[model samples]
Target: MEVRASPREYDGTFVTTQFGAENVKRAARDEYRKLIDKHDSEDVLVLTGAPTSTDAFRDTLDEVLPGATTPYVTSPVVHATDVLNQTDDRVVLSDALRRELRHRFLADYEWETEYLRQASEQPSFIEDLDRVMDTISWQNISPEETPELREITAALDAFHNWLAEHDHIERGQLIPEALDVLTGDDYNDIVDINAVLAVEFEEFFPLDRAYLDALTGDCDLVCIAEDDASVRRTWVETGAITDYVSFSESRRASGVQPSTRPAATAAYFAEETVVDDPNTGSVSVLAADSGDNQLATIANEIEELIEQEGWGYDDIAVATKQSGSTVTETIESFERSGIPTESATITGFGDDPAIRELLAVARHLAADDDNEVPDHGLELDTDRLARVGEMDQLEDAIRWWATDSGVKERIAERETSLDARSQFGNVRRAFRMAAFLDDTAFLDATWESFEEMLERAHEYASQQNQTSATDLDGGVRVDHLQAIKNTSFKTVFLINLTDSEYPGDPFLTRLFPTERVASMPDYPGVTDLSNTDVDQTFPTDSTASSRPFVQYHAEHARRCLAIGAEAATERLYCCLYEYEDTALEERAQASRFLTAAYADLPWVTDAADPKITSEQAAEEFLLSRVDNALADVRRANSQDVTISLDEVEAELGEIQELLDKSGVRGEELRKALRARVEFANGEVRR
Candidate 1:
């Protein structure tokens, strides 16, 4: 990741960049730090596209490069906005705090962001404002859309006025103001940026690149894209990289390093190529009857790898293609099957027990009616939140309340469990929020506002602003396919590879149609021509009426599938199901991508071939034995059948004892065994 031999004579700074979700940036940051350290160099700054936070990134930097010349890490907007703010030193409200304040102001002034709904179906107006503001595209609207565009522009102005009333600035003003500073007579960073090397620049918009280019005129402005498995120093000016190199025939992963070479279509082909035994186990297609069957199979397979091959739980991963409830269900499925899973995807703060417990007390404090927190059916350690009687500060109040309620103690006591680590992460966020509330602006903040901020924080935390796979430390990783980018595992189970999910439906906004949205003028990603076509991609029927939209998502799915395949270093399971109660149509089929890639993929699908781990060998043996015994008992009255009653009793006893160890085993199997026992007592039924 070293700066390509900069022509600039000055060795100014190490400015490393990464592009992805917040988790990706954090993960890449650690990886980059290790790489830089290995090269005997250290970064002086960290730039990410996340406008939501700098404190968390700073916290990340402190944990890694602590006590060293810590890099000045923040979003690109903050980096420039702060530079412009150097003149007047205006207070910048974080995106999180600003959002809550906007709602409060809206409620107090009887103001409605209803116009936002008129423009976009999602009424997620703040994001709409951010989009136009970040790209400065509000000024470049068509004549037909002027009325609606004007409404959005006016809303932006009103927001700015409100922000000014509180003597605060938002990130929306950062780029424009910073640009003004850059275009003007002088800027300090312009001179300081003797060289600017941006590594793996994943999300540089035109405005962002312009601002950076303005800051570092002719300095070493090299952006190395490291997002793709096959990406080399591919130079992209817009920073939004999409054209990752496709699988090279020679570069294809084998039984050693696994990779998902996407198929041309979802069709299976007969090839003369013979699959080797070891290679069969390396990459395979696993199918099941239902979700329960699939998860049980996955758990069994994971256990097989651990017990038979000495693979640690951490080496395995279950990267789901779906999100939200599906991911949650998968986690619960693994838990029920006694598999420990560290979810890299956020389940949100609403589900966190620790956060809810603390907030229940906060709600009580705000009402000033009770000192006791209702556990909401939770098995908490205490009934009453004791006031420490030392300070009335909210942060201190929360600390003592948690201490009294034993929430903090319980969190601290947990060390090894995925649930424990996950709860600890939430508790840490709560404390961070508490510290943020202790700020000057929030001195008069209400409990309603505090809870609102926590809601948004945790919601964002769940969305994408969270940890990478490495942060999970231990346990089998369960995350979405996209979240596992730039990561590797020894054995990966890419489940939910079905038609409904693999080439997922395109996310078209209610505000705009997806007819060349990526190619339109002022299209934000117009310069990233990598997404301009889908000639090689096979379109899905998800949006069959809209070929353009379907193609767009189809290409996306192909790329994502490739990413999933590349994550596994040794074994990769492209699993699907025959029936899922949660399926869109109640009957699931294998992903076309799997079939299209079948000929090129390494697949050995024999259930009893010792290669497929999707079925438990021990369970199969027990079931087969029970089936043969039942067949003989059914014919006990016949001359051909030999009913060995004593031997059968001993065998049934052993199986029964084993079943007892497994929580009474399968009821169906128990019923079959009982039927054979009944035949011995002269009672017979078909």
Candidate 2:
């Protein structure tokens, strides 16, 4: 567990008990101590809904156990393989490796398979098939309704079997497979656990609940959640959960009125009005001209939070609904502003110099084409690589080549690069891909196919949405909205709130119609199809069939907003940009969610007039003051009026002294008084 992912740093000098989330953690800690006291550490299991929560829970364990051993702690979505590994013989694949294998299975998928033959005709057949595999498979579709379902199921069966044959398994199969092993008579030999605790029960799926239920009978079971109804309905009646405790009021940052800010911001998302007190200084909004402008403005605000409010860099976090490219851009922008940020966004790993170097060598040794096979911009290792020729194993051959070529060692030396953790992770991830390839695939793998596999791995891996930020090293975090769900910060910036991006339209699955999937009550992605508060509903008309899915996404977007709002103990900034700074220079509209939020949020960033607080601001203010005074003096001389200078002379002397320090008036104004300027890197402006 990465205990410092969000760094649990609150800005104000408040007592910890008043903090709402702190109290929540305290309650959880007491519960953990209770469990550990009664059961041995190995006999207990603690489950979290997300990686961030897992990290937070780990932090609590450190406080309670304090250098003592902690019980098994995990977020199943991330640690499923770790939990399910029953033996050393099988190869467990993360999403990236699984996708590479899936593509391999499909490429050689017998031409006779009905679904493959039909799907092969389409240009996006692979993409379509990948999406089909990604569907949660909670709904049971009968081929009687559509024969395509039968063929798809067969394809899936064969795929799973192939993975098993290779002594491998995809991640989703880990929990269910583990259940089979644990339920057997010899289960004690595999896993010996007597108690289980699942937190954030509201986010658990039906399958997760099933796994929790299977753990009952001999073991004590408990679940911590913000809501109680679902847990009671599923587990309490089923007798899996024997008791429930509700922390009715969650207090946050116990200085002044605790939890006031988090609760007030949460009210807007709940569609409730918040009575404002200007002194509350909790929720605010900022709109900018473009993407770069928005980040630059945010960078400045973050500086204000640090320099003026005494907020530490660790107290701040900036999250976005959009990731991948947006996250990469945030890293670039923050680096330029001299703000250190910690993020686990490894989406750019495929293109990094080190990973690319490794891939190039693999392709050069395997691929026949000889044009510009990269060699670290050094002389040829071709003689050695060519002499090495082909080895029995794909992974070993690559390792052998790399060992002799010194690529991994070179990448190990790439320490000065920021986000080096991710770079190294990617390097390992890239090598992980090699293990999936056999001698056949390695020798015959075209340069294009190799690159394509890397790309496919990245695309599939991103869907897991694993933005697991690293430890609390006193750097502000830039992560996805989902990554920060259960982690609290002193200030939270929920950015990229424009319609073109936020609450984005859902995509249609390849194999099934939206109507079919949405009609199932067991759809695990959303809560209560008929839930009216967030307007989730199934439409009566056939033409409006996709409404339920769309509503699911819209509701999810609002839920993310609420999580962000609740995560901040003191300040929250809902940020957006009017344009994306593209070649077309198109304008963007505010999201419906943001518009609705603005109706209740009174504090808005003043674009026209903002308060000046820095030394540069003072210089610009004073320059303007003296220029206007000189104008007034000239006007009075023309009108032949005697202007009193006795009092003004002393002030003029002081202004002149400051102006001399600020340099020449023109240069000073350009340096300090420039307006409409969101960002500048030395002389370069955007």
The candidate that achieves the highest TM-score relative to the unseen native structure: 2
Q: In model 2, which residue pairs have backbone atoms overlapping below 3 Å?
A: 18-254, 19-251, 19-252, 19-253, 20-251, 20-252, 252-259
Per-residue lDDT of 565 in model 1: 61
Best by lDDT: 2
Taking the candidates one at a time, how many backbone clashes does each contain?
2, 7
1-686 per-residue lDDT for model 2 (tens digits):
00112212211111123223444566567667778888887677887755566776777666766456765777655444554654435766666766666777777666555756876777677666765654433222223333454566567677878777767776666667655655666555655677776766554554555555555436666565542112112210111121222322323322222345554655455334454643554677777778877877787777777887898777988887755566767866776677767664434553466666665565565455666454445454667766555555556766676678776667668543444655666776766666555433322444345556665665444344351334434668877765676677888888888876657764346544466555533332332244341231211111222454465555455656666676787788888888878999888888777776566556543333335444434444565665556666777889887777764677667765665666666455554434312222234544
Rate residue 173 of model 1 by lDDT.
68
* lDDT tens digits, residue span 154-253, model 1: 5556777877776777665667667778777776534454334343344444456556666665444334332332111111122124332111111111
Q: Indicate the worst ten consecutive residues by lDDT in candidate 1.
A: 245-254
Q: Estimate each model's TM-score.
A: 0.64, 0.71
After superposing all C-alphas onto the true structure, candidate 1 shows an RMSD in angstroms of: 9.9
Output the worst ten-in-a-row residue range by lDDT, candidate 2. Answer: 1-10
